[model samples]
Target: MTFPSPKAEAPAQRFQEATAAARTALEQLVAQANEAGWGTEEISVALLEAARFLNEANRKDPDPADDPAISDTPAKEQIGHGELYD
Candidate 1:
């Protein structure tokens, strides 16, 4: 099935700019939420829901790693430069 496209197409730089703007807006939302007395659980839940929405929107191809068992299992190796933090 084909998906519908928006009226305007965003270039790579435009997409990057949108990402940065969304990130900044989300950060400000977190700060406001904290000031409004939202706890860690509430904040994290909101963030996770937002992430899920983004994943659903941006997912073009099937990702086999999202299978039940694989998704639930702990990662044996680092992702990207995970060792850099250690």
Candidate 2:
């Protein structure tokens, strides 16, 4: 089989890396919010939602040889979906 083009492969690799990074960032955001005593539950929920979205993206097209997976949802949605805050 012909090898996949690097142009197509690079983006996928980047996406996977980004998704992994986002997961870590979301966890930190929740922890920080809790420490600051500012809507800890709300922040935790939002971060959880973001993590889910990222996880889904990672699962959709998991090409380990390619780019990292990342969430495709809007930032606002990740921050506001299914939460007491909104």
Candidate 3:
């Protein structure tokens, strides 16, 4: 009996396309910032922050397109609404 060929599911493919778009946008932003006289240190910091934010967001709900090599990790504990405003 022949086994089915492994292939990326539709949701996963869409996720990958979205991620690629985001990365391209980020590169464009960096180029614009550089042309605006933003120093490397400042740009690097902003990019790092953006990466951190994305990481946190991904941890909450990982993209279905993520490679199978990426192991799933437990999501961080969400703060209560009241606690957030406190």
* Alpha-carbon TM-score of each model against the true structure: 0.43, 0.37, 0.42
Clashes counted in candidate 1 amount to: 0
- Over the stretch 12-58, how does candidate 2's per-residue lDDT look in tens digits? 88677666665676667767787888686788777679879988987
CA error at residue 82 for candidate 1, angstroms:
52
Cα lDDT listed for each candidate:
0.67, 0.66, 0.68
TM-score-superior candidate, 1 or 2:
1
Q: Which tens-of-lDDT digit does each residue in 1-86 have in candidate 3?
A: 22233245698886776677666776777788899999767997989998999899899869847554322422232234333223
lDDT of candidate 2 at residue 54, scale 0 to 100: 80
Tens-digit lDDT track of model 1 for 1-86 = 22233334668766766776677777777888899999757997989898898788668535755656634544554355464322
Which number leads on lDDT? 3
Worst 10 residues of 1 by lDDT: 1-10
For candidate 2, the 10 contiguous residues with the lowest summed lDDT are 1-10
The per-prediction CA RMSD against the true structure, in angstroms, equals: 12.4, 15.2, 13.3
73 in model 1: Cα distance from truth in Å? 46
